[model samples]
Target: MPPALTSGWSRVLQGERVLGEADSILKFVPYSDCKQGCSGMLYVTNFKLAFLTADRSSYDNTGKRNRSKILGDDDIPLTNIDSIYTVSLSGKRKKMTVDSKMPTTETLEVHCKDMRIVKYGFKFAPKDQNKKFVNTLIHHAFAKKDTLLFAYEYGRSNELKDRELICDCPMFDTIIDWEDELQRCKANKTWRVADVNMSFDMSQSLPRYFVVPTALMNNDIQKAASHFSDRRIPIWCYTHINGNSLLRMSAQDSDTDQPREVSRMLDAVKVASNQRNKPKIVKVEEKCPSCQEVQESFVKLRKICMSDTMQEFSNQDAVWNTSLENTRWLLLVSRCLAACNEVAEEVTGGKRTVVIQERTGWDLSCLVSSVSQVLLDPHYRTLAGFQGLVQKEWVRMGHPFQRYLSLVTVSEADTEQVPIFLLFLDCIWQLLIQYPAAFEFTETYLTTIWDSAYIGLFDTFLFNNDHQRYHFSRNEGKNIKQFKLPSVWKWDFQLGSEDFSFFKNPLYLITHDEELVSSLNELQVLSIQGMFCRSSRNNSFTTSLEQNRNHSQDARPERIDPLKKDLLVPNCSSLSIRLWTQCYLRWQSPAQILSGGTPTQYLQQCVMVEEIAQLHHKLKTLQLRESLFVEFRSKNDLIVSHQPNKSKISELLNSTALSSSFPFSPGPALKEKQFSFTPICSYIRNSSLDYDKYVDDDWTGTL
Candidate 1:
């Protein structure tokens, strides 16, 4: 095979290997290593990724190169790529780091792993072409990933190239099913939106088809914009008689200044809006572009006006500086979740769909939308809907579980893995613990999902995109139809809810007859526990919902004194509680060998508030020293003086107000659950039990 036929501007592919007709290979780039002087044509087919080696003396029928040739050995297996990212080729800083005489090249890093890591680096022509390549690579990788997942689940070994893909359709008919359900339920409304309850939000950032609130059609709205044509990505909407919302997932904005794209989003959101007018972009911040001179001036002036964290870079403090930059993404996700909860509350779906950007609308977008739905929509909590929710959101919406599977065992690299799915499940577990009976599945169900997220149990949850997943699952593979893959919920039918009582979350949310607004304050973020679980005061085997609810509703305050449960109960492995933390966590975290000689140790140490208080008291007795003097300012003179008061000082020193300033306080820790007092909120202050009816109350601030 001459390289010229496989590559160059005029290079063409017959694509005989790809089953049926191949989707057009839309883009191509010439990849060359400046140092090695090796060249190749980087092209992506519908089913596979192949790069043909090109001879530098490359002239094709198009007369582009001097002499172009293809090397068949250069093709890369797209399935092996674990993660891919690009390097910046712009900026004076970036330019200075490389040779000026070198070709404009983009560093493409592909991390391939099976039993070990095999990294592939491709230096493609043109600076900053890395962005386009990264997307193409990921999207293609996802397509291959879906094929592999479907094949694996169908008991097809890695070698089964002969099996045919059957479905060639979408996953679990969330959209199609909902459309029929909606139309049958309501004759008046025209639900042309398809699946709003589940779809991929087709913003630039969210290019993949995944579970979204509903899929939105960008092409329908704008025939003028070139990019917006025939683009029907998921932006599904689920409407209720009382209210409606458009929970959307989108790719990040491609054209930052594109008004037509923004207008499309606003229009789609406006469909679910309760407002009389359309919502406008609320510019949160503004920046002024600086010239080279201004940029240099700012750099020189940096010392005079800079954040407290800013300091001169030095090898001695390099360790500290590196961690600060690494922590930015984690902090950003936390802040975004907090802000999204607030947005969930103020959604004016009656007039406008509250559009909270789901961490730029992809992985975390699926999580944010699903969690928000569970809170707002009661349907998600149901048995059937919860299964649909996972199928639509986590499965259809792309959560790269394959990339995360490596996390089960410890690897040196943890940077590429995000706990989006884990965190989402944690949030749901909290709901399950709070409202157990409200869900059809038991604790076992949650744990099973968590485990599967780490293990490749079901293919539905593994694929990277929706469209290819649809094709792969149905039409791509050649297989016998009699051995059909079983439904994921087969375990539910096998074992009734009775046996999985140990998996139950203590809390239960009973559905209300009338739609009720769940509070934003209740959406609290929780931590990941893999190997161990924190001690819970309630230890009775899954009791009846009535019994649990009665205890949950009781107003009795917990005592600071240590409870018997802490001293009597032993620490248990988190395998029973949190699956990801216990087993999957083994790689990143090693199980410490305990002194007791048992091979297995408890997941976490059972630390209770009472035990903590006792330890604190013991430590305080040992560490607290008599302060010879205390500092105070004279009331009239703004001067501090050191004076010692013995008897009264000792009492004041022991008081919580004073002890609170100490680095460690061990006394019985106060918790929100332990507080029986009704909060003195704004409403309480202005109630019918007026201040005038009682004694003149002490006020902190003057009116």
Candidate 2:
């Protein structure tokens, strides 16, 4: 027989001593060399996967000149491997490859994310052995739980490496009842867990979607499903009050709405297999116009688009008009959306966890699931919180950001980009008009998200989604910092007064004395879920910019609070003016600069534009406040209900230091919850008076 899998070792491979992989096998695969020129054998012990060359300096163990292997000077650890697969003649390649290859010989390609895919020609002599080598390598490659596990699972595996998970690992207590596909993340010694105070025994269930109180209870079940032998996974759950939360997923059209479970197992499996892309993280649509414009976003905001009164209007003779069919269809959509909203409200407000799945579990599913969080959580009402929500729910969760916006082109066909996120913004716009103070960010912020989203200015919004982007990052050997990714909002903005607003959403604004959230406008509900394109003639709502201009005289400095002097905001619409002025400020003669623009000019323009934006936000904020507290003084409700945003205003331009300690609390809605700030500390563990006395090298204090 060939050399044993663990043969040719200088010393006995004791795996358990390595990193708690005590029971794991010590696998040895001997090959001529890897494409990275790792000549010798691959020794996969518990601690790491190392490539060791045949040692020439052999130590004679039994007083015999027996050649034995010792540690090579240049061994490479394969601990951070992203993917390893056998390259069969698989019909050439998916993309063009510059290098030539023989159709017969098998090449074992190991794609380490940080670097390129290293190709190793298998010289195992036996084809079966080579195949087993590739298989065995992949088996241990994925079933790992080291610090790199999260990065590997999320960042790598893009090559579709097969992993038939063997249920050898012990399950977490929270997931005993969940499907096997819903595996919990492997614990890493360095990473921290949710605070003990924030975690609680979440045993309750409800019809509405709720955040899972326990960790390991929530997962990107659909995404994780693709990695397992069984392609079934539980729904993505999140932390919520009453142990309930809502999820939005796409579904089939009304024609084929229900499933024929009455069919045989094979038939059902086939049907289910076809719907694998469901629980879609982003809105993906096919077909469209050549050019898209910002003006196209107004259609979803119509009053009738969200209400259920379309059925009553369709009774008229005008209903037969084909042009009216679009309206009718939109109305029907609104009705369905309303029903879903009602159900969600019941569930979110009640104690039920709701899972809204459409034909594919994207589109509508994303809309409702995300919007539900905005409705239920007050933290989401703030600018920092809103950014956090999108990061967590859309970007981090995987919403196909790359597919929607073409990275290469500035613009594309209307149909090429999905306006799911746009629809969400428009819905927020309606909320802003209704609850002027509910969201910290204004219409300006929403408009900025749309404008910069396609430009790829920030890495946070650059990727298609969390998994696809990070997956590629791992392939390129990027630093996979746990619980952190590139973000668009700066520390100054997040901690500043510019992003703070004390106004509540309309439902909450009017009834602060009662329940947290009572109701929402049906029209706003429908606006949150569709590609609404309304005729310009029917667009009725006047933009806040225009409204502010008509009443500019009323907003004069003399008539307003002198406190507004501290506010540095300008009108949101005046950004173009600022841009022009800024560009002119750096206009060195055309002869001094090349015919093309200079980097200095571009950089200067960016800075000026940012300054204008900050000023505009302040202006709009102050304007809105004036309209409510001063200009609209006759409106008793507006004046009487102003919430003093004492905290938001205090640090408009201040840095939040990590060393500062405070008794942090998670707002009213999340009364029992605790916040996580890695660089910052909310409370000190040690309460003794001498705790602060030790200020030496061995302080041993964590912030």
Candidate 3:
């Protein structure tokens, strides 16, 4: 029966050899809330844990023959796993830990970093097969030593030898990339690149090369390092054209008094930023919400978003506002935005340099610094610039990725695993919604990055710092000539150009610096209202554009000058914060709409815009050809009956197909398909659109 459950080794990466494989494994249905189980083949590789159903015919009907199913939605990256458990027949779950004894249970459950839970039953397997498989999975997935990570093994492999190495944006791995970024921001005027930590002897967490105040000496940096946690010294993040700079550093060591060297370093940074005033230090622990608060709020919010049954969702929907408010997620988001705005105001309006500090300087420190730059700098709003910003602030600066987004099982008491990166992305999404054209990237880009963090394919989000990545590769993986790890910025390997096109904002427009600074006063007012009021006037920049488009047949988004400075700062009011449905609710059937909801509408608009652009290009080419033909005809006495018609071309520009198919209305034939398992690491789209027909990519699945 069921073709004897074929081996799932074909679902793994080229270099990822299977360590263990078991047939007749039953996967508990995720969509059914773990009520039913289906027989499948379970495979554990160095990279991931994959489960392929015995009956794959229904899914294979998609007709993708050549595409490599290296990693499927049913697979979970070993590094993305959060916790593991042994499930008893009596419905009792015993949490698995590094030191805990392995149970001879027939069923097991895995919890992931992305708030997903998957269960599997090991019934009908050979004697001791379950124990052998469990031991292997735990040893590989929860590698105690950094050198044991699959990154070292995969990095040393020849899988990528023949693939073209191309990246759309800078990986920021080299010194030259940092230099270029400093030059682009004009921070070089006051800051200079420091390489005191070249061998990671000074600070293991901080990058080898980073920018610091020109006035600060190497010895001063050394002395200052002792005062802060993780030795993450005050370093340049971004610079304002007004000579005000943004800096980040870890909080002072507990139970210690402020030292003289720390004072000297702060003075140097202040003088470098502005000769007149001292730098405004924003203590994240004091000003913003705590990591514990964020973690608790997200737990409640996720429970609401991932409701198991239709009745459960309906009940939650009846008092959705109250339930959401109880979670304090929006409240936390509002507080975070308010804190960022204060820093923005100090840097821009107050004309003072700002230094953001938090415990260990990785969590809240990274969040506020990045969000402030988004408010003050237009460059960071662009896709490439934002990638560089994350590289500089989060990855290079060391955000404890392994600790926060852990590979191994986490204990109930562990609070280190916080969603700081996701929170930062959420803040960026709010800004994107308030000012759509201001960003070169879409919300999809942010969501994609969130998914990429847990994928484990890229080493970008693998280690806690550069020190670990460097030493681990050098000590364990000596096969590769260069110990270079793959960066997520090289996205061409993961997705096609057409899929990549979705990340680019079709309505993107660059605004003048004067226009960016012009709305400061208005922003100050909105910032105050956002903190106190439940509801504020809907001053969305896109509102007028939408209304104008509704009135006229061919009305483009108006480029309103000054952008209403108030719009530059997001409305942090609870009512203003919309749920990121494309991310959190994408898996829930009850939460999903028939035509794929707002995200699909947005994607459809992006498609329409690209089509219109292509048509315009074709029309221009035709006109150029016609002009050349006429010139040749005049000289050679050649004549043709067919002539390019300008009027007809104009008529073609007004085609009905170019109209916005927004709020994505579907036909009667487009019915919702019930999925047996929850899809992960896949972009969900409107099933009715038949998007795969053109793209033919399996990763981009239908809803």
Instruction: Tell me, by TM-score, which candidate is best.
Output: 3
**How big is the positional error of residue 334 in model 1, measured in Å on the Cα after superposition?**
4.5
* Lowest lDDT block of 10, candidate 1: 597-606
Quantify all predictions' global Cα lDDT against the true fold.
0.35, 0.32, 0.65
Q: Which of the two candidates, 1 or 2, achieves a greater TM-score against the reference?
A: 1
- Our tally of clashes for model 1 stands at 74
Model 3 alpha-carbon miss at residue 285, Å? 1.5
| Cα error of candidate 3 at position 603, Å | 3.2
lDDT (tens digit, per residue) of candidate 1 on 1-703: 3344344332232221322111111122212122222345455433234443454423333211111111122333344344544434551112211112333324444433221111233433433543344455555454323334323434332222222322322244444654553553241243353332123343222223222222245344333223332232325434333344445534334554545655565565554434455642211111111122222332322222211111322321356434433433223333333433443444422344454343233455566566656654556775556766676666654555554443222233422344456556655654554444445444445655554443233455444555444444554645534223323444332232222222322233221211110220121113243111122332322232233332232213364122211111111122222222222211110111112111011100111211222233334444433544322221110001011222222222232111111101111213223322221122122333222212112211222
Please estimate how well model 1 matches the true structure, expressed as its whole-model Cα lDDT. 0.35
Per-residue C-alpha lDDT of model 3 across residues 91-116, encoded as one tens digit per residue:
67797766677777678877766666
TM-score for every candidate vs. truth? 0.40, 0.32, 0.77
Candidate 2: stretches off by over 4 Å: 1-232, 237-240, 248-340, 348-351, 408-415, 474-485, 491-703
Tell me the alpha-carbon RMSD of every candidate. Answer: 24.7, 23.9, 10.3
lDDT of 2 at 402: 46
Worst 10 residues of 3 by lDDT: 633-642
